[model samples]
Target: MLRIDGKKVYLVPFEEKHLVDPAYYAWLTDFEVVRYIGRDEYLKPIQFEKVREYVEELWRNRYCSFFAMHHSGDDAFIGTAKINYLNEAGFSTRTADIGIMIGDRGYWGKGMATDALFAICNYAFNDLSARKLTAGAVSANKAVIRAFQKIGFLEEGRLRKKLLISGEYMDHVLLGCFREELHPVI
Candidate 1:
């Protein structure tokens, strides 16, 4: 897909050039940004090289399709969303996991995430022919969970204490949305 344009944000194919901005590297170590997503310990010094290597892998990996989320009006890079572990075309390859991160602090709690999630999910089910999409969020991350639900993902199960945050064990909510569950987005 060239791009998935949402009401407020546009999801473009992730490219190496997207990393040129200093904010992209800085968000990797921001405590508040990575908190419930795990990696809170990234409090250590930020290394641009290591971050580049990670994004490079995503760029080259066939099983992953990552997108740089940009605000529609100004085209400002806001964050990223991804579909990982995409199985090759076949009757059996009908499910994938979705992940997202709105690294821009200024955009937090502004519904941009919800918009991006819906756009990617549309691409997954409509374009990719994915039968089901799954996502996991720490139960403490209510915002992520709510976004998933807003996009039609239903709570399927829970992984108890699957995540350790702030020295406390937290449950992980498992969510899944099937093709039939999604409203056709034209």
Candidate 2:
């Protein structure tokens, strides 16, 4: 589990203990928020038992870093972030992929993603011994694309028709951030 504080928020691994939180599940399964998450969309709100089982499976996989984004004021679970897709092909152990979602629509556009990203970068470099991080954003998601840029991820390339959303193909923007390249004014 990775713990990050300050920036008025924190991120830690989501455990089975959190799955039973109805509020968390309700927020996550909210279609309004999940519209832009990934390759597939969840058809129905997940059952607590299913979510718990997923947490258990992920805990065992060790391929994903799923965190519960929390607000410091009340320690409330607001969203999530993940770092996965570790590549072992090269001699250098320097890069991984990142993904995040702010489940609480009420908390959107509040620098929550920025803060969470900074913490993730810190984890990548400090704890995971990584040198770089990568991510892909849907072409139409200006907020997310800009968020990645705000965190020092430069636009790398574009993949046309990479994803099908609502029966239409959408492009993807590949972006990256390097550990040695981040500059934090603290």
Off by over 4 Å in 1: 39-43, 86-91, 184-186
Question: What does candidate 2's lDDT look like per residue over 78-173, in tens digits?
Answer: 887877744453216567788888888888988888778878877877887777788888888788887778767899999998978767899988
The TM-scores of all predictions, comma-separated, are 0.91, 0.87
Q: Please list the residue runs of candidate 2 whose C-alpha ends up more than 4 Å from where it truly belongs after superposition.
A: 39-50, 90-92
- C-alpha lDDT (0 to 100) for residue 184 of candidate 2: 56
